[model samples]
Target: MSSGMQRYTRRTLAREILLILAGLGWLFPLYLLLLTSLKPDSQIFSAPTDLPTSLDVGNYAEAWSSADLGRALFNSMVITGGSVALLIVVGSLSAYTIARRPGRWSAVFYLLFVVGIIVPSQLGLIPLYSMMRSLGLVGSYVGIILLYGGLWIPMAVFLYTGFIRAMPKDYEEAALIDGATPFRTFWRVIFPQLRSVTATVATLCGILVWNDFFTPLIFLSGTDKVPLPLAIYEFVGSVATRWNLVFAGILVALLPVLILFVVAQRQLMRGFSGGIKS
Candidate 1:
């Protein structure tokens, strides 16, 4: 082989080795988590780093029943699903309007949303809690759904607006010329083209909502409406010394989000590539 080809092959081999090492490094913690979870308390401390001799599936059952994970899982699904759906609808419409309109008002509104993304949600936490409590929204599914929707809509709008602005207006114009109403044009012609961005928004916001602990803890604490994160948290606290059970609870909590990412990974990649290309 030529010297240049030999050099190229060596470089590629070195890069592959480095990537493999990095991937293993990242996965080490998860490996530990799985190993520890499969171990009993007696083995967890003694052979902490060793692989399990036998699978301890009881840890999962114990953790699930103790944490009431079934209910928490249901609650998480409701909140995450509801919030993402609301965000897609409102955020897309808002972004579409802003992108299609050319005026100072549109710029101002977009700027406000940008600012919203920058601002910390904690700043208004106390006031928000007080208001929700007064309205008897505290500890309710509707309350948490609305809060998450409002909090995440700004991010969704920012993403959607950028993608929409980069998209061509020909489809929308053609729809309008064909006697379609603005709403119909947006839903039928424009929205269909925004699948990538919508998927991006949904996946991003869905993960955040599903994993969020603080908001649910604040609003839904001491209630049966707690989501997976909070439920896992409470479970951990109760079983603090039992690392095996704690890990089992955590693993259970992680499954749904992991499954979601696995399912949406292709769309997620397309969305990211579309955003960059735009």
Candidate 2:
């Protein structure tokens, strides 16, 4: 090979090796977690680096029964699903309007939601909890659904707006010329085109809502109302004696996200690419 080509090849090889090492570093903890979870407690600590001599799945059974995870998983799905649904409706509409129409008033409205990206939800916990309580929404799925919806809508709006802003208005204009109302034009023409951003928003906010611990802890304390994260919290406290079980529960909790990432893996990345492909 030419001298310059040889240098480029060497550099690519070095970069690949470095990335492989980093990937291993990130995955090693997960490897350890699975390893520890499978080992019997007697062997967990004793054989820290060694592979489990035997796989014990009793820990999973104990985690499920002891922690009431099945119900919690269902609740999480509902809250997450509801939040994403609300976000899609409100965020997509708002973003499409803002993207298609540019004005001082529109700018102000857009800015209002954009600012929410930085406002930490922790800061509003006090009044937010009070409002939910006043509305008799405490310990209710709808209440947390609204909370997640409200908190995440701003982020979704931001993403959708950025994405929609890049689109040609020709499709919308053509739909309008065909005598469709604005909402119909948006629903049939514009919204359909926003699938990439919608998927991205759903994935992003779904993960947030599903993994959230603080919201459920504060807004809903009933054992039946709690989601997976809170159930895991209770699992840790109640099953402290069973480290293997705790780790097993933790591993179970990670499965949804892992599955989501695997399933939407490509589309999720594309969504963030702003629907712009080379």
Candidate 3:
């Protein structure tokens, strides 16, 4: 091989090694959490560094029951799923309209959504809490779903708008020329092309909604309504901490996001690239 090519290969290998090391460094905490969760209470403190000689599945079972993780998981699934679905549907339609027909009204509405992205949700917490209480929505699935949908709309719409603008107009024009209705054209031709963006939005929003702690903590006062993050918070008490159970609860909470990332990683990357290009 040429000397230049050899040097380039060496540099690439070095970069790969560095990235692997960095990835392992980042994952070390998760490994420790997994190890801690698998250990008994006695083993947790005494031999915290020691790898488990044999996996102890009881901690997982205990953690599940103690934290009511099953119920929390269901609640999180319902809220996150509903929020993502609504965001995709609403955000996509809004974005498509804005992209296809950019006028003063569309621009104004889009600007409002852009402004929302800059404003922190914490600023509205007090009013939001009062509003929820007045509406009798606190501790209700519908309340959290609405909050997630509203909070995530700005970013979702922004991403979708960028993606839709990048899409070719030829397909829509052809569909119209072929006697297709506007709705049918968008549904059949335009929407399929947006799969990458849709996956990106869903995965990103799903992760955020799934891992959200503050919203659930403030709104889901009832144990039954608590999502995984809030449910995991219950593992700690006023006087002491249940480290084993806490770690176990964390692992349980992490599983869904991890699985989601793995499944949607390719489309997520594509969507990001498409969004940036757009």
lDDT top scorer? 1
TM-score of each: 0.94, 0.95, 0.93
lDDT of 3 at 82: 93
Tens-digit lDDT track of model 3 for 175-207 = 999999988888899889999999999999999
lDDT of 2 at 277: 29
Q: Worst lDDT window (10 residues) for model 3?
A: 233-242
* Per-prediction backbone clash count: 0, 0, 0
Worst 10 residues of 2 by lDDT: 269-278
1-278 in candidate 2: lDDT tens per residue? 89999999999999999999999999898888888888887785565578777899887888888888898888888888999999999989988888788999889988988789888889999999999899998888889898998999888888888888888889889989999999999999988888877889888889998899988889887648888999999888886666788888888888998899778877788887883321
Deviation in Å, model 1, residue 163 alpha carbon: 1.2
Clash tally for model 1: 0
Off by over 4 Å in 2: 275-278
Residues 1-278, candidate 1, lDDT per residue (tens digit)?
A: 99999999999999999999998998788888888888876786766688777899899999889889999999999999999999999999998898889799999998999899999999999999999999999999899999998899888888888888888888889989999999999999989988988898899999999999899989999998999999988988887689899898888888887788889899888876665442
RMSD, every candidate, angstroms? 1.7, 1.9, 1.8
